[model samples]
Target: MDSKRYIQLLKKFDGLDADTEGENTRSSVSYAILSNSETNQLQKCLGARLFEQGFQPKLIKTEFNNFATDSLDTEGELFQSDLDFVFFVLSPMGLKETIPSELNERSQFASSFLSELEMFVKNFSNKGVKVFLANIPETSERVFGNMSRIYPASFLYQIQAINAGINNLVAKSQGLYLVDLASKANYYGLSEWHDNGLWLQGKYPCHPRFFPTICDEVSAIFSSLVGKIQKCLVLDLDNTLWGGVAGDDGIDGVKIGDGIVGEAHVQFQKYVLDLKNRGVVLTIASKNYEDVAIDIIENHPRMILRKNDFAVIKANWEDKASNIQEIAAELNIGLDSLVFLDDNPFERGIVRDHLPQVCVPELPEDPTEFVDFLTQLNLFETTQFSDEDLSRSEFYYSESERKSLQKNAVDLKNYLSMLNMEACVKPIDEKSLPRSVQLSQRSNQFNLRTQRIDEMTCEKYIKEPDKFCFTVDLTDKYGALGIISCVFMSLKKDHLYIDEFIMSCRVLKRTVESLIFNEILNIAKENKAKFVVGEYIRTKKNKLVENLYQDYGFENTERSDEGSLWRIEVSGFSDLDTSIKVKRS
Candidate 1:
């Protein structure tokens, strides 16, 4: 490792410390690096770097002193005194020999740490603490080209497995994140281990010159773990001071063609467009003639985004809330998922007042700094990007067509019947867990009890005989409305308590809810449950469901300040006429 690179790395961590000091800091994360001899020195170096980065890191010294209490719970008590995240740094010796022998073949004492770790996660997660796990640097064959003492291949493989298993276990147990830092460390080699050096000194990976950059990247990943980044960017057009009326400017004159102002808007639009490509849903909300705006989007030479770029567009003379509602409806997305943007403060204010779920970005005085302003907002940062986000705009366009067709039909049954709607209700599976969790998190209007559970928790329910989760998938002539609803219930003697019930807004008037209710009833009948009980948890966005149970013939049996409980006798409940065809999984 180069000495200058080590100094640079130290400086980068110092910079992070300066940036985070006195910013309503939380309980510091106590990181424990579990490693042996050769890796011990490296862990110490990383620990030193973590201290400079505004984090406290500790290396646990494991010895065969007091086999039970001191090595397990008592020792954990000493180490986990105030720990937030535990980073396990493994080496060839640490994996094949150190851990298995030291921990004694997954003995009862080893099991103790797993339990202790679980408790830590549940306690900390409830309080909003984050955890991260980083593996040691990958030893590159190319970089270690002539080194005689190479790490044994079997040892490397075993260590990787142990690291992966521990990472997954901790993630499941602690709800913390596992970041792959090994490849990154190797890429940067041992250059400026910390930054505070010349820019060109540690920019690339080919030479041993980017260690500071690697440290910077690791610090950034940790920072991201501590915060939830905005997922979408909403855009607007017309003179809050763009040059001309989109309708009147005739595409060429409208400020976004090829000049300074146009260049600025183009740059801003391109910045947002890139965010969308990286899985942020970009939407437009402009009060303009739709045809004129569409023309400009199609014909403008400098415009990077066309009609295809926007996930949804709200271009109408209607109030911003109403327009935003349409946008949400078309996108099959929740209002909370949107970030509204417009030049007019009045429009922004109206949206802020009516639709509090949507994020409204402040307008910058200089149009030139619009892109810079967004960067400052950091409104579109995310760690994971799924494939669905890339084609979200096209999906919304298709959904609009579905909605238009849905409106033409007379009633719920009629609409469902005409479209040939099919509902597939099934026990929750791995493939549908993410969507189920999303329903719990996002479905406020039709949600009952608003219980949010991650995939692991959901998996437990599906396999539990006493509890059941049924998700609904609907497909019409238009397209598939992937896993639109979920119902989690616990079966007791003669009664079933509805723990969770939520449906997507896109399937609102399509008799999907009625079909789901009917399916649950069928299940209850088969199980010999006499009645179904439902709990309603009030939230800001779930007012639409205040009378949901009443509308569905469920009578209030219990009421309290926290939530309302309703009950319905299975025998007495009528099977309502629904046009939706049902299937079981």
Candidate 2:
């Protein structure tokens, strides 16, 4: 493939490219390579590709060292610099002799190396750097083995074991990615690269042709890691969800009974279940009755998903785009997280135009292709799966229930009182710091300002006398809602500047805002400040918070080309009576 074709393929693969634009702008990402060679042809190819696309490519030379010397410290020095990715080249290294035994019996050197690598990744991830592990060329295997025929039997096994170790390390490291170079090359086979075989090809060990291909693969993997994956998969009911439409042919007539189509849906549901297992939230935005959809999913012999499978279901009579946004609000997730799936082109087009970030998968004519299509479109891939993934669907499902409770109430004030809620506020310590920063970066609606703060920045803010950051954990008689909200404020002059005020949409209309206002006013009063000020910065998905200041009686005192600002007098601002008991940490 040409450079353009390579880029297109990378986009198709949803790989990383820092200068991603046009149709593949969503896939833009940055990457760096870790290598033992500084001037290899593969590195040149990588640099060229990145340069053409206006992306800065990083390359690290992996020089061998005698552990008896200060190689570890030197490696540490190299790692302290800015790096997002590393490809440990195993070729030049004499792996056959080196792999089976540790440099020391305790394996201290290797452990230290891996541990340092892990620390680097964690620190970088906290700074928003994504790292990937790349497999060294397989051609190096024979070369290394030829040089160590005495250990011929253990040669391949040794390299495999080292690769496995790297894989394990990558899996354990947060924000670390892996590129299966060996597997990909093996799939296409040696014949594809060489006239005789991969070994005979002119490109064999540092092969010029293989370098470009491998570089492309590495670049593609990096692209995929840089951006946020789509969160929710909004599925249709008919052939998309199940096998047939229940409205046309009745519940029994639906193809999701005990047939081939039925099996396809069964597998499809299992796939969706796997996504949920990994925290990719599922929601149904179908044009069918809620009861009917639930019945099919619950009672059907072929069904694998149940009523609780969906985080938010919009089975009511509504436009797909409208329903999708509603789902986003209910789950407290962004519209960008939504990936709308429909069998009909019209519905897909509607969502595509109305909700552009809501990824609308191309409608395939056949149902069997559904799995393959989605597999290729790995919109749900994450760098790591957290404990939260297992219960995310239930969390959003409970969020929907909370919304239902709010809807029946007379007003926001009454709704908050009726819930008999309590807030558990806490300073973000070591245990809660990651989750707090993650929420700060990810939370969309109800967010006053969308500042993507890092963990270090959060720590610094928490220590500042002028600033305050607190997370609110809310729970009522309904269920335990974990870390439902957060607020960041600072004292400035005669006012308490509300820098960040965001609550989980699950806690919406529950007087969380009023409670926050009261807390801020109390802080202002205690600090001897005369006024409380706040800003409403606009993001496409956070329009819900634009009028938030008005709800809390904060009048617009300043308006500029940048954004709107509001302030409430500490003396005059009345603390809205809230039933939710507040506890400060």
Candidate 3:
């Protein structure tokens, strides 16, 4: 989007009714910004961009330098604001005022600064607010001239040391995220980013022209943190994966390897393949004959992605929008998780108009710029990568086989039993911690309570006696569906509260949910608890599990629009029968 049009869209956000607009009442995200420089313009620009992206942003700007002390002081405004994310924007110029200017004292000053910043981050994170800490960018003006570059004890070295320290701190702290402001400034050109006039008039560090770019970066980070990451990339075969239409130009004529245009498509394919390797399901939603597309995918030597790469292939004459919806249903993923890429503007428009949730990026006029355009969008930001991610495509492929087997079975129970399913339930340990955290972060549709936590928090729960965290790994005759489910519970005085009970949608309708419920009851029994309490937190995607508690024989203790609370007496609970074999470790 152009800058002027982007600003105009932001202007429209000022009068929008925060309650009636967007998909849900919870569309609004409360964020607090603490900066050493002026941030009113930044807040307005960021809020506008966030609002445009289906989020009603309510921003609370704190006084400059308040981040250093506000988090430490219990009575400060930072503690009072109900915020989902906290942004601490820093600049070398702002730090210069507080840190000692003397070269000999700078090392001590840098250490003290990092210590205080680390404490602030820890305090805010302990309170459950996600922190976005900005790396201090090198200022345009240099006080030490060339001396700053060569000397390790110079002011520049101190800033570099502090930024490196911040990176190390964020690596260990799950709740803290680093925003690469220096890279952003470099990308926009230092001259274009720094406005002396604006800095002199108001303490604003960057020019107003660059706010849209800044907003885009920040919004991408926030989007990934909130679990809005894209899961599937639906691609068109003709003029998308290759340089020409397969039906008209034949597989040999399609440009995908040697020349300039061919290499461009090949690069695009390589990027898509990289995404596939990291858990993003690849699918074909093209308007072509299925036989021709499948032949090319299987036989083409230049193709980086093979026939087994795709989870769903809809290469028929069907409309793009209908094909995408069918693909989502077949794959058991949400429409919002699909990202459509096509060279034809008409096809893209049809999908965009019919299915608004799917992220359909506007293809550049030139095919060579496709990779660069997609890279700039940063649509696939992720918090963590695990072993399960590397094998996700295979898991989905196995699911496709399971669906075929289901169609051939005599009955639902017969189908499940024929698969020879066995579930191994075990406590969360070092090996399962990463996948367990991923499940909590990504599982939405079948999740009850929808509680998301980081690896640190998951580890903390595992060590706490009152808390119970375990994962279920399922393997059938077809393949091993690793860590397909997770259960988290808190044992209070006489009650066991189920904080999260989530299962993969692939294993739904196989009585796996009953197995998990029975396991929770058994844990409650072992803990000598009187009641097992469960909650159903309603979300845009979790409607599939709305009646989960009632289905499991838990009586509704309380009900509201937000969610419902259910409880079952330990003595009254009975184990639900399932054909699948169970193993505990």
Best by lDDT: 3
| C-alpha lDDT values of all predictions | 0.61, 0.64, 0.83
Give the TM-score comparing model 1 with the true structure, all chains together: 0.63
Sorted by TM-score (best first), the order is 3, 2, 1
- Candidate 2 segments exceeding 4 Å error: 1-229, 289-294, 316-322, 329-333, 363-369, 383-389, 459-467, 489-499, 520-538, 547-559, 564-574
- Candidate 3 colliding pairs: none
Candidate 2 global lDDT: 0.64
* Per-prediction TM-score to the true structure, in the order listed: 0.63, 0.71, 0.92
Candidate 1's clash total is 9
> For model 1, how does the per-residue alpha-carbon lDDT over 1-585 read when each residue is reduced to its tens digit?
455765655455445445555344332445443323222233344544555544544434333212223224533553455544444333322222433433234333224434444454444444333445455443322322443123223333333444555566654553455555565544444232322233134221222243333344444455434332344556777853245678776776788747777778877777777776776767777888788778777777767888777766667788778888877766656676677767788888999999976878888756787876766445553433334445445555566676677678676556667788888889888677766765565455777776655455677788989898898887777666567789998999889888888886667767776777788887888888999998898865677778788888899988876679899999997787677888876
Candidate 2 on 250-331: residue-level lDDT in tens? 6788886477887787778788888887777888888888888777777876677787888777888889889988887667
Candidate 3's clash total is: 0
Off by over 4 Å in 1: 1-174, 178-232, 238-249, 254-280, 316-335, 342-357, 362-392, 410-412
- As a whole number from 0 to 100, the lDDT of residue 292 in candidate 2 is 82
